[model samples]
Target: MAPVSDYVKIDKNPSLQVTADHRIEVVEAPIEKPGSGKVLVHIKTTGICGSDIHFWKSGNIGELKVLGNCILGHEAAGEVVEVGADVTKLKVGDRVAVEPQLPCGKCFLCMQGDYNLCQDVEFSSVYPYDGTMQRYKVHDERFLHKLPDSMTYAQGALVEPVSVAYHGVERSSVTLGKPAMVAGAGPIGLCTLALAKAMGATPLLITDISAKRLEFAKKFVPEVLTYQIDTTKTNQENAVAIRKIFGDSEYVQPPSVLECTGVESSINTAAYVVRRSGVLTVIGVGRGDINNFPFMHLSLAEIDVKFINRYHDSWPACINLIANKVINVDSLVTHRFPLEDADKAMATSSDPSNGNIKVVIED
Candidate 1:
């Protein structure tokens, strides 16, 4: 590898952006140097996430609207080529997985180690912060986790979503040998399935409306019971179908449910399917208000409904899982694109017919 450059050309930073009209554009901005407590990383690979597609297509995710041109990407891996003052844990040439959310360390939630719940968080790819779709990015050192030598750049980039999955599982308190179900077969849903299995969740079940996605899940985890949800059916009916698919037995109902789709119907189905006193972890980001929520059902069952913001203190566990082959993220990367073709990557990822489980952009 070449020596780290002491000074980089302060010229244009090639970036992928979503215009106000929701059009994908390749544009340029001025490069920035790492500030104190930060590191300048040469982003090697960035995974296109569902949230990115939401922003690219609608120019917003619920209330968080894109006021102007916004660069979109958060799951990224890179090489630390430059370190700023006071950065000690990492140095030049270190490979790292970039954790894109930067929370205020002084907040009450942050002090309690729930930084993801911080009131003032500057997350990448959000309204004010540019994401890692560019060639270079400056991030706080605390948010970057070193990748093991056995991990590829693509796998490193996947750590973000993996962490999200793991955090959901953790919050749900999934017990070993217990039944579990994931509500979607998207990247995060697949990740949740893999993690739940690794943690010893038996007879796993996953549901998705997309036949291609469900087929992909079957291939990913042959033992996982795959269900093709009927959208036309009411949520209560779908919930009944989920239970029936699990079979009629005392151990048939899942005690843990990870609702990864954020769709109202899926969430409602989850609300009904989860066993009494079950744990329901909502991992997907959806509209602020969901109509027809079966609050009475959830309350009557004494089910604990938990929501995860983003992951905090999860990178190390995610890295360990990937490095040890506990989770095979490498297989989830179905499409790869160069940084210049980021627009196409986003387009392909948005289309379920493309059969893209996960799309990555290489620098």
Candidate 2:
């Protein structure tokens, strides 16, 4: 039988692979025809994420180790290119968001409706699993989420990150009408700010040192109170600025905090700012175990702390929210590149000083 299409492959070294400098090379391999319960998709827009950069430079993140060269993108939206014989839910030409992580359906966690913690899940852009950086991908039929007629491909790509914010919010269970603070102005941070407002919080305040990102957030989040932290200023000064906004004496203590920056200082700020019984949701992944925190503040303030792992079970609800216009995600993107520029896009995302809000790579 003749193959209908060609797929790109990233060569893998099965042995002595640690010292070898990994690079992504494009080569054509036979495209496997979809089998039962699979759907082939032609990706439209995919975004380079923080995890993607980690894999590109270091090839391993957390417990997931990259054993070989692999495609590197997970946040994506695509058009259904073909469907397997047994795939009935989705047909060709369907516009959908690819929820890149697929958990084992029979896992104990999945049975409890907590699939994100599935022990034997396949997450895209992780080590040993190829990503959606190429032209086409064949995904499990259950993982495909058809987009609403109002949602654009670019907007669909934003769903992955939006899901991250939704999970963070769920972790905090933010009290409506209470004041909240978001300490990172990155894509996830900005997304959290928007989500907070959508949930009825009063003008959630967000802070970042980068003027460009602050400006980007200012465009849609006018109510967002931003502080352009002068890195030259001592941490004490930054803390003082934060205290003044929430006001140690006048206003109610900070009850909710979202630390999305992943910096040690940001975590400290979140801890110190939240009031007694406040909830601080750590949504960022610090470079390492290096994030230092002021434990006394948390203990003294009686703050409850929780951290987020990768998000799951959020795609359908998130897409519905976006399709219903509950949140404006389209404006969050600042740049878009094709998959050919994956390297450049990764480099840009590495530089926090670059001021890019979100950069999407179109396939």
Candidate 3:
């Protein structure tokens, strides 16, 4: 390995950052070198996650507030430009996907292969730690997965969110011929739907409050059923409606439900519609405290409620899924903006009228 001083440096590393509430800007900074056991990546593509939008718009998602100009992006793919000492797996010129979560490897959860729940985990785009929106990002060697030649940088970036969906699907135990319902047509929900299809989940269903998103989901996955939720109705009413649509008689209902919308109504509706002894995996990040949750109903039905923090041991599966065309992410990316125009990309993603499924920032 070459000495740190011999590393090539870009004079200005343009980074998209959430400077304050409702403000995101591209700021220039000096490029950084990879430390030991790390690799410096020239980020080629990055997906704007909902969490990034939350922090960019409101400066926080719940209690996780942005204290300063935090760089805003996590779902990213790049090429290794420099490799630090002891980096055995990756080398210069390798294309890779960034797994943004940095967990304490020595922690009990990490040893148990549940590092996503590690207490000391430092995730990208969250406050204090910078993210992959910058031109160059130095990440640990363990967190970067080399992308297949078949996968594009946008698809590589999608591996992060797809990994999250993979985790939820695994927790939900969605299998062949299992009737699965995803309660949100957002990025993660759409990903879960595709994975369910790949898992051979027959009669798949997806729901969302936005008709536009539901329409897009239908076009993207024509085999899956789509439902536009009536926001005016109560959660219980919506649940009954969903049951009616699924034609749930006295004995049949969706056994595996992935709640990708963290809204209270969506969660409650999912809980209500799930079959007895079924699994309800909550993947969306929303309010910590939900009001009027159907505690007694879920208890009586014996539904197993599971929650996903981010993901663990899911990157490879996602990579294979995308690389092998099990999940076609080409349609997922609706808009692209250069890194210099990242502000516009974020704005396009935030606006519902634009009808964007996924907005990507390219270098």
Candidate 1 segments exceeding 4 Å error: 1-3, 6-12
Clashing pairs in 2: 254-275
Candidate 1 local distance difference test against the native: 0.89
Residue-wise C-alpha lDDT for candidate 2, range 1-363, written one tens digit per residue: 212223423232111112115555544333446778887777788887777776666766666767766667888998886678778898777899999988988978989988988988988767666677767777897998999888999999999999999999889857788888888888899889889988888647788878888888788688887877768866657767776876657256558888897888777766766777779999987666654567776787678999988787899999988999888988778787766666666667778776777888776
Number of clashes found in candidate 3 = 0
lDDT-better candidate, 1 vs 3? 1
Candidate 2's displacement at residue 48, Å, is: 1.0
Kindly list the per-residue Cα lDDT of model 1 for residues 1-363, writing each as its tens digit: 223556554355788988778888988855677888888888999999999999887788887888888788999999898888889899988999999999989989999999998878999999778999999899999999999899998999999999999889989857899889999999999999999989898879999999989989998888999889998998889888889887787366899999998988899989888898888899989887899988888988899999998889999989999999887877799999999898888889988887899999998
Q: C-alpha displacement of 191 in model 3, angstroms?
A: 0.4
> lDDT scores for all predictions?
0.89, 0.77, 0.88
| Candidate 3 residue-wise lDDT, 54-79, digit = tens | 89877888778899878889999998
